[model samples]
Target: TNLEKRELVELSTRGLSRKEKLIVILYYLEELTMKEIGLVLDLSESRVCQIHHRILFRLKETLERMREDLLG
Candidate 1:
């Protein structure tokens, strides 16, 4: 389970933009709060929230695709 989780995170960040990569690393790896991430990235907290949500949606899509590929 741990290995799978690490792989999932790696896969999630593999194709991200630089800013998106940073956000994921900060939020997941560094375990930072969204407000803290916003401060580090010089973005408003709400903006970080928006971007995080978007990132999550993209991840969901990616996961779905991977699941389909695996089940094929």
Candidate 2:
């Protein structure tokens, strides 16, 4: 499962923009390459990579925040 899907399953609601969600689903769930995602999304490969990184970083941050909230 994609990170966002897992997060969404656990959290029920995702706090990301539409593009971020689409990127996550394509990259992780659909198992698409950056080039493939770019082609499908009408973005450049470099832009897809950037979006992937941003989505990953955002998910990580949200997970950390959730952990802190749970622990504290």
Candidate 3:
């Protein structure tokens, strides 16, 4: 079910703001380090980590909600 998992992640990303999406792409897709992401975003490394954590938490909630809706 890798395709389904990818679909769910795609759907969840739709709820992200522009900056959040950029951070996700830069970090995961582009394989950027936190320091590199911060340089690209003009933020400190700590801030990038904070944003990353928040994005992950939000995505987790969104994916869970989507799964529940589909199941129901």
Tens digit of per-residue lDDT, candidate 2, span 1-72: 457667864352277777777777777667899999899989999998997788778778888998999999
By TM-score, how accurate is candidate 2? 0.77
lDDT winner, 2 or 3: 3
Quick one: best TM-score, which candidate?
1
User: On residues 1-72, what C-alpha lDDT tens digit does candidate 1 reach at each position?
Assistant: 767766767888877889888888888877899999999999999999999899999989988999999999
Cα lDDT of all candidates, in order? 0.88, 0.78, 0.84
In angstroms, the error of model 1 at 14 is 1.3
Model 3 Cα lDDT, one tens digit per residue, 1-72: 657755655665787889888887777667899999999999999999999999989878877998999999
Checking candidate 3 for backbone clashes, the offending pairs are none
Candidate 3 ranges with C-alpha deviation above 4 Å: 1-10
The TM-score that candidate 3 achieves is 0.78
| Model 3: residue 40 alpha-carbon error in angstroms | 0.8
Q: Which parts of model 2 are misplaced by more than 4 Å?
A: 1-13
Stretch of 10 with least lDDT, candidate 3: 2-11
Candidate numbers, best TM-score first, in rank order: 1, 3, 2
Query: Candidate 3's error at 59, in angstroms?
Result: 0.7
**TM-score against truth, every candidate:** 0.81, 0.77, 0.78
